[model samples]
Target: MFKRLILFILLASCFLGHAQTYQVEKGNSKYNAFAFIEAQKIYLKLVEDGYATTEILSKLGDTYYFNDDLKQAQKWYAKLFAHYENQVTPEYFFRYAQSLKAVNKYEESDVYMVKFNTSKGFDARSKMLEEDSNYLQMIDFQSGRFEIANAKEINSSKADFGPAFYASNNQVVYATARESGSVLRERHTWNNQPFLQLYTADADENGVLGNPKPMSNLINTKYHESTPVFTNDGRTMYFTRNNYDNGVYLQDKTGTNKLKIFRSYKNKGKWSKPEQLPFNSDEYSVAHPTLSPDGKKLYFSSDMPGSIGYDLENEFTRSDIWVVDILADGAFGAPRNLKDINTPGRETFPFISKTNTLYFSSSGHQGLGGLDVFTSSISPSGSMGKVVNIGKPINTTYDDFGFIINDDTQTGYFSSNRPGGAGDDDIYTFLQLEDLREECEVHVVGNVTDHKTGDPIKDATLVLFDMNNNKIDQQITGDNATYTFRLDCDQSYILRVVKEDYTSNEEVITTPTSSGLMRTSLEIEINRIPVADCDDIGPLLDIQHIYFDFDKFNIRTDAGYALLKIKAFMELYPQVSIEIRSHTDSRAPDQYNELLSEKRAQSTRDWLISKGIDASRLTAKGFGERRLLNTCANGVACSSDEHQLNRRSEFIVSGFGEFKDCD
Candidate 1:
């Protein structure tokens, strides 16, 4: 089982001494030792001899469940529910639901999950299922982010997993239970296979691995040693091993040897004697070490104290990913639980990629079934973002874990125990087609400043609009006078910055097509509105001169452009009121010109009112021949351009006492 990395035996009282037969007790001994294969044999023989109990049926279901044989597990679980449904606990309901899901009996799986939820209140796993009832559809929709295949050249018929990149030599180091040339190798009672040992193999440009060989004797032992992670410089290694030291294997008070992480340094072209990390405890297991890309932090899975979902009676119920800061003095800070990433189920085999993505395997989060691979982004300040499933075929209805990747090449390796593998757990190489984090986003970041003073302007609002003029996002500048909007890459956006008493600024920018934290910096500078006295008639808001056809009072298309600016200015300064004054040249009759001027002014006011401006904020007045700018008076011979000046509109500021001060 995948739990072999840090084995835990959760024995029931029936497995202790309550068995009615000697043969059943013998089976119980094997089961207690995690030898599920041997225990299954004895349990199957008893069932064929017409001997079965609730304990025997439950143990049979779990034996297949732990061995990754979900079909058989489902069969036994069905029998358990049929004969002793009321006798089993909620844990069995969860396991049976998972097994049913593995066989694609989703409807039946949901029935047991609901039953499990009814029995177990406030369980995060059940809540996740309830929230994402369409999880299978979601998984199918997000599939095919990776192209994966088994690494056949280095795989054996036994378990081969936990691959780590040895970048210094362009090789990959992994763990395996394959036989060495040694004639007398001890087998682990848990699986009846030789203990896992470290092995290195060369990986080519395409990430194909071959030419496997055992690692140094100092690193490997007759006991278990696996899951090695090398530092960026490849001068140091952190690996998992049983609690063995000073030429002696050690066990805790419970008579069980727990796993511990050991660090080995490379000096003079040889690996130094490994030393156990200070955080490892004999009472709890700590294994599967991974390092941050910068090598300033170490992450590993453990069931130590304070681990989420840690049970004192059965510590194997769950394990969480924990991290510790690698200090400058080569020591470690206190470990912190990744509370955001861990759930009430097992979360193990954490690997941080070059892009600061934390990839791990977990049965806690919503997945297809079993432990599925998941990824979460790490912020610059070391906070965790949303956790996302890497999706199929990188994940399946079986244990898929130990994911590692190279951001530069977009290729990587992971381990899975899905069917069609050459071993119980085989390492597979994959080419990532897309990032496992959220979609391709570009951070649109910039500062808003005063145009004249060149000083940052806080409290400025920036509104983003897409090409279709749809509002996308909005941000307000803080004390730093900076605004950031995360937008899709390779798209054009219009960022409009608006501040009180300042002219609004707009900038159209196109983001780069490349991915991964791309940023477009734009600094917007806005000018303060000029001070104007009451009753002043002028184009003070930088609006263009309004013009119209001869003797026509209708608002023309060209005039609409200037009116739109007036509408925007009115919206910006809600307290300002303006009077639209219209004038005409002396060519028309005096009474006709007065009527035409009034019509023009009324049309302008009506247009603004139609655009959602309050009627009280505007007034229309006809100043026919009274406020002519040029010398185009009555009966005077003048150029048409000179008369055109008179046939224009003036926006008189009637009420703006609030903006009296220029500053």
Candidate 2:
């Protein structure tokens, strides 16, 4: 919902044929007006009355997804996929993946991810995923170079983002949806949040922000105002606001007010009223402004159509970064889309650093997930270099954008919703630790090689698993057979190695809390598991362990991959019949653990059957808490790692004559 300047939607009454079409039409009108809550109620009522048309089903999913009701979104999205599998679009596939990830269904999400990539192969969304199949592993194992903390003094329990450093001053300006002290209470229907307004705060020498207050009333209005930018001389400022002039507001035929860039002058210590920019219009939005270092050009984002490389039939409409020449006479030239940096997906929140580097956020680029911040060098001729994602601890599977840097103090701030935060969107500060060498931080450097011949292995997938057996990060070895990862301190890790037709390997390594940032070298020696090993098939196949999330029976992505290996082994020795045994840790009561283990056993069998194994070739059973691999009994206190060793599933060869056991 952040920086969503494009609120244009059209009603599709032409597709309605049921008796409840009138109610659905009313819902569409509410949806166009951004009244998502009212629109959701009407859509739900229609569904309850047996109106499950394709349009209504799609609208229901959209409402919940945009409202951040990820669980509900997943439910409706699943139903929609089951009913209209042939007509689903790439956008729906992307949204379905997002919702699945939110609910920790990473394996199922990957299933949709493959379909989306196949359909939209040329989009950045597909290219990014293809480039880094193990991005999650890389993000989880990172021990960040700079220490990050929430800007507590300058934040409120509302949506706050888009932080910009004031020109040559310690004060920082940002946008927030928090209510001002006044009585204006117009909430955006897309989200029930209040309209955004500009706020400023001062940062002290310690880089702590405090004493935030609203900006001049002349700049803040009843409509939204955000993304403030100031000139180098600090005499003029530029910002984004709704298309409201004097006492009347200009809106498109859809009754949606478009955003426009405005300028304000500061004279004799007071800010003047804002004047609408000449290039603004009521048809499209032109917002999120940033100026070049020399003040010769102004950059912003807009969806005015005719965008470079945009296709109208693609269904994925997004804004492109546009720039205009700011002439010396204080006039603006025609806007040109930044083809080098912008993609078919949304790219906004432009910031030009002191070193002539352009920093912005994009959903179209290859990233961990969601909106990721990227950097590109701006040449003296205003051309852009290759854009690269500024990877995690800073970026995550959630939205991370509105990045800014301060070269004067070598300190900067950005906004994110990754895990722990003060609000929905919190501003975090980063101080470049110059004294601490970047390469000296805690890390793991390793090479994957064949155990038999000592030859370097390329394209080998290496994953880092935490002490509790959760997959943290992953990387595929390059031609040099090398992989490096910044690791968290004082944590134990299991390096998992998997390659085609080779036995998977797991190596345990622990990092000391006092270890300075330096490379911890490791050599992963993986050997080939011959087909003969599958004959006995009782833990000798070197099959990797099947893991699930805490208190869950569903398979994870890593576990799903591991199961495929087991299925292949079964095919290699078709005469061998196997019994599937599942177990649970001693955390819950005996009855509950027994039921959970049974469900897990059945789930494992179901997966194998789906992989083309005969159902009669396997027998499912659960051991519950009766099987303790460690000393963690009922009353014993143990670490999560110790307990995880007990929650496992194993396949035991029951007989060599599978014809007798055949159904």
TM-score of each: 0.63, 0.62
Task: Please give the lDDT score for candidate 2.
Answer: 0.76
Who wins the lDDT comparison? 1
Task: Write the residue-wise lDDT of candidate 1 on 503-561 in tens digits.
Answer: 78888988878543443434454543564546443446665467767899888898888
Off by over 4 Å in 1: 1-20, 182-184, 313-315, 437-663
TM-score, cand. 2 vs. native: 0.62
Evaluate model 1: give its TM-score. Answer: 0.63
lDDT of 1 at 118: 77
Residue pairs in clash, model 1: none
Instruction: State residue 372's C-alpha deviation in candidate 1, in Å.
Output: 0.6
